[model samples]
Target chain A: DVKVTQSSRYLVKRTGEKVFLECVQDMDHENMFWYRQDPGLGLRLIYFSYDVKMKEKGDIPEGYSVSREKKERFSLILESASTNQTSMYLCASTQIGTGRTEAFFGQGTRLTVV
Target chain B: AQRVTQPEKLLSVFKGAPVELKCNYSYSGSPELFWYVQYSRQRLQLLLRHISRESIKGFTADLNKGETSFHLKKPFAQEEDSAMYYCAHHPTQGGSEKLVFGKGTKLTVNP
Candidate 1:
């Protein structure tokens, strides 16, 4: 089974505190993604990595960053957590191919900022 | 830029009735569309994609390029089908490989 596992399902952080959300896929997918899901905004892409050490910004990459040091792992970093950053973060991984290929997602990390 | 839009924020339908979850996308070029579902307390997973034209759990979606839409449909709605549904679109190739998603619709199938 292709499984994408997150480091934490729930996280609590204070304002200005640095936070890290980790995701790993056993499927060896070459592409990984980080997205923050909001109530009415859907899932906004924060960042995505097509290869190890290669990262690019997504639609909503203003307050987020990502790392792909290993092919199976992708990490999302919040330089400084803020109240607005409190949202459901989802991590996904997929093989490179046509746009039709599907991306497998983890359970998700619900972050609460205070 | 590729974008997806799910017009309905919520949809309520009775069990055994037909269900349709609308999805519209905007892309500067040709696009690939997908439907993903998240059951209550369950992880999100892909339900179907436009290109493959496959059906899972009796749900099927036909991509209409002319309308720039890919709508998910089920002949007989099941109570279990009540969940959050999202429509996603991604580019054919290149940098980021980011999948753009719509706000999603909360589907409620009441028996």
Candidate 2:
């Protein structure tokens, strides 16, 4: 079975502290994405990496960054955690190709910033 | 700008009743559309895609170019169908790999 594992299922952080969310996929997918799932707002893309070390900003990448130093691992970083940043973060991976393919998602990390 | 829109935020229906979760997209060219579902405490997963033209778990979606919509429908909704549904779109030509998602609709199938 294809799996996308997130480091933490829940996390609490203090204001202005740095936070890191890690994700690993065993599917060997080339495209990986970070999305924030909020009530009514839906799943908003934060960042995505299509290749190793290459990243692209999504609609909501202002307070977040991503790293894809290796093929299997993608990490989301919050430079300064704030109350407004408290939300459910989801990681997903898909094969890179012209045709549309299924995206495998992680269990998600619920982050609470105070 | 390319965008996906799910007009309804919440929908409720009795078990065995028909259900439709609306999805609309704003894009210039023909884009790939998809419906994703998230059950309670479960990860987000692909329920169906427009290109496939196949039904899964009794759910189906058709892409209407004139309407610019891809609504997901099921003839009879089961209690298990209660979940969050998100509509997504991907550009077919552009090298960009971003998949844009709509605000999503939460369906409740009450027993």
Candidate 3:
């Protein structure tokens, strides 16, 4: 079975602290994405990487950054955690294709900035 | 700008009733659409895609270019069908492979 593993299911951090959410996929997908899921806003893309060391900003890339030093792992970073940054973060991976492929998602990390 | 819209924020229906979740998009060219479902305490998963045209778990979606809509429908909704559904659009022409998602609709199938 294909698996996308997130480092944490839940995390709590203090304001102004740095936070890291890690995601690893066993499918050897070339494309990985990070999204923040909110109640009314749904899933807003924060960042995505198509290849190792190549990153692209998404619609809501502010206050967040991503690192893809390796193929199977991608990490989301919060430089300064704030209360407004608290949300459910999801990581997904998909094979490189002509855009007809499905994305497999991880179990999500629910972060709380207190 | 490419955008996907899901008008309904929440939908409720009793078991064995027909259900339809609306999804609309605005893009320049032919769009690639997908429906993703997230069950309670589960990861988000691909429910169906427009290109496949295959029924999944008794659910089907038909793309209408005239109206620019791809609505997910099921003749009979079961209690297990209650979940959060998101509509996404993938840009095939652009070099970017990112997906644009809607605000999502939470379906509640009461027994």
Please name the candidate that would achieve the greatest lDDT relative to the true structure: 3
Candidate 1's TM-score: 0.95
Once fitted onto the true fold, the runs of candidate 2 whose alpha carbons sit more than 4 angstroms away are: none
Task: Return the candidate ranking by TM-score, descending.
Answer: 3, 2, 1
Error of 1 at B40 (Å): 1.3
Give Cα distance to truth, residue B94, candidate 1, Å. Answer: 4.2
Mark the 10 consecutive residues where model 1 chain A has the least summed lDDT.
A93-102
Model 3 segments beyond 4 Å from truth? Answer: none
Docking class of 3: medium
Which of candidates 1 and 3 is the stronger one according to TM-score? 3
Which interface RMSD does candidate 3 score? 1.2
Interface RMSD of each: 1.4, 1.4, 1.2
Residue A38 lDDT in candidate 3: 97
TM-scores of the models, in the order given: 0.95, 0.97, 0.97
Model 2 lDDT at residue A36: 97
Tell me which residue pairs clash in candidate 2: none
Candidate 1: count of backbone clashes, pairs at least 3 residues apart or interchain:
0
